[model samples]
Structure formats: C-alpha cells, structure tokens
Target: MLFRFLVFLYPVIRTLGPATAALLLIAGISLIGYAVLRQPGLWSWLAAGACLLSAGLLALLCHSYHWWLFKLRPHGSLFIPIK
Candidate 1:
C-alpha cells in the first residue's frame, strides 16, 4: 500500500541524483558548524569533527563512481549476453 506509493516515487526523486544529497548534507554541516563555533566550551572538538565530516562528504560526492577503471580492456565479454 504505502510502500508501493513510496517505491513509485523513488526514481523521480533519485533523478536529481547524489549531488543534491551532498549539497543538503553540506548545508546541515554548515549550520552545525556555526552553532558549534558560537559555543565557548566545546568549540575545538566539534568544529574539527564537523570539518572532517564535511570534507569526507565532499570527497565522496566528487569522486568517479566507475568501479571497473583498473583494467585496460572493456569489461564486457561476448559470452556474457547483454541484459
């Protein structure tokens, strides 16, 4: 019932792709960083962790997704029929 409706909507939402998720995460981190920076006692550790997390997210979003890049030849074989 509800699951079917949500599943139908999944592709339409995913059409916007990973960049949107990365951007949203970056915005959230920015807000958190601002709040943490304002606090006097917990500034250093919170800011460091937030910065590391944001950097990791950015790195993940920007990287190539191709998993078969190491080989010189194309991954497809004649024996393996196309789906």
Candidate 2:
C-alpha cells in the first residue's frame, strides 16, 4: 500500500532533478524486485502492474497540464507558486 503511494508520487519527486529522480527510481525498482522475490504470486504482480499503470497515467496527466499551463502563460514562472 505504502509502496504504491510512493510509486504514485514518483513523478512529482522527479521534478527535483534527474540524478535524484534516477536514484529514487532505482531504489523503488529494487524494493519492487525484493517484494516480488519475497512473495511470488499472481495477485502481487497484478497489483504492482496496476500501481505502475496508474502512476504512469498520473505522470502523463501532470506533464500535459504543466505543458498546457506553460503554453497558456509564457511568463517565466513555475507551476508551483512558491512563497
């Protein structure tokens, strides 16, 4: 459950930087591999797949929305309003 949540937030965290994102992604993959090896089951695989799919979809949606916003407003401002 927590792992899925982390996967879902993967893209968001990726905005930090490529190196950081790559490291985190590798860690996540390792964790996933460990889970699969520890408990090899059909349901576990299905759940992992589903989590990955949803996370990818979410990342796509976020990227598209960010692109749209950038297109709509070309000002040099970030999508996240930092104070």
Candidate 3:
C-alpha cells in the first residue's frame, strides 16, 4: 500500500516541485525590483519572468530525460583544441 502510494505521487511531486521553485525565484526577483530598483520597466520584468518560467519547465523535463539522451563525444589530443 505504501509503495503504491509513493509510486503514484512521485510524478506529481516532481512536476509541482519545479513549478513551485520557479514561482519562488520569480517572486524574489520582483521583490528585489520593488525594494532596490524602486520601479522596473515592463520589458525587464517580462524578461525575468520568462527566465523563471523556462527554468521551471526545464527542471520538470530533466526528471524524465533518458540515459541515452546524454551521449558523450570522443575526446582526443589534450594539447590541441579545435573548434
């Protein structure tokens, strides 16, 4: 029973956790703008807002990433760097 509950709740918790964290970052930034900057422009606020949203969505997707998604490239010649 306990194991079943855990399994069911894991994905819910994972999705919400990232979303909540993202909101917190956004709120913190807004507070800073209000307190220190006194007042920020609409575009600046929107840019910060976008960053917070993207970060949270990214975090959520990261939890579902497959091991095969992370392929490593071959590394050779430590003395030489090529672009």
Which candidate comes out best when scored by TM-score? 2
lDDT tens digits, residues 5-62, model 1? Answer: 4344445434543656566566657656666677444664566566657656544533
When 2 and 3 are scored with TM-score, the better candidate is: 2
Candidate 1 lDDT for residue 68: 19
Question: What's the residue-level lDDT of 42 in candidate 2?
Answer: 70
Candidates sorted on TM-score, descending? 2, 1, 3
Alpha-carbon deviation at 42 in model 1, angstroms: 13
List the lowest-lDDT window of 10 residues for candidate 2. 74-83
lDDT computed for candidate 3: 0.53
Q: In what order do the candidates fall by lDDT, top score first?
A: 3, 2, 1
What is the alpha-carbon lDDT of model 1 when measured against the actual structure? Answer: 0.48
Worst 10 residues of 1 by lDDT: 64-73
Give the clashing residue pairs of candidate 2, or none: none
The 0-to-1 C-alpha lDDT of every candidate, in the order given, reads 0.48, 0.53, 0.53
TM-score of 1: 0.36
Error (Å) of candidate 2 at residue 6 is 23
